[model samples]
Target: MKIYALLFLVLCLSQQLHAKEIDVYAFCDASTKFLKKLSVLPLEDLVAVKSAIAASSSLEELSVASGVPYIDWIEDTQKQLLVSESDAKLIVFEQVKPIEFSRYSRVINMHGVKDHRLWDKVLNDCVSVNLAALID
Candidate 1:
């Protein structure tokens, strides 16, 4: 019986570990060429990008302001609304949905990466109206 219990515990731990190793797709707007053009290291680039996002007046403003061109901001909004539905506290995919297209009026999408100083700044600045916490 003890051996069986130990085996069960091991199985459970393995499952939990696998669950935590989730795959989330992170995307930047196509307009974010400014960051892309830089040859800096990943850390430096991310910091610079974060600074820019933090300074934006709103998410819509951020999207427009980003250096990546051709990014579909309209599609991004739909993703936010969908992630907000499950009470999941985190969104892990990359695809943008279709429902939020009509409402995408150069508006803000509060969903963003976790642990980003810019994300916190946006939260404090009232740029992201929904202010959903993102995953790191």
Candidate 2:
């Protein structure tokens, strides 16, 4: 029993030490302008953003929409990543306001209109670069 307990503790400690850290960024729209803006970001920043997004739990969004218990989870996850609400970037093409957890760095209202051309441009760019493949 003692050896079993020691082995379990060692395994747990090793896993924690090897855990990957992630960074979170909030984006409103997928547009060329937004993509261009992101292109200037440091490679580390981009990696962190991707890691955070990939690790993010969809349950949080569901909880937000359903009025469920997500605050604790969000807070805990953000804490783990050392990201504050102010540090999170919110990028969007529309005039939509940023949410509580994010800060808007650039917002192009475009008269409340959305341009699919820009959207498609961004999507095509993403596909060409295989950005989705990097998420996991």
Indicate which candidate wins on lDDT.
2
lDDT per residue (tens digit) for residues 44-130 in model 1: 444554555555543344554344322333333334344342221112112111111211211223222334475435323322221
- Across 1-136, the per-residue lDDT of candidate 2 in tens digits comes to 1222232222223234332331111111323355445545565554554444334445443334323343443444345446663332111101111121121121221222366675555445434333232243
Off by over 4 Å in 1: 1-37, 41-50, 69-73, 76-136
Q: Model 2: runs farther than 4 Å from truth?
A: 1-30, 59-136
**Model 2 lDDT at residue 20:** 34
Q: What's the lDDT of the predicted structure labeled candidate 1?
A: 0.30
Backbone clash pairs for candidate 1 read: 30-68, 30-69, 31-67, 31-68, 31-69, 32-67, 32-68, 33-67, 33-68
| Winning model by TM-score | 2
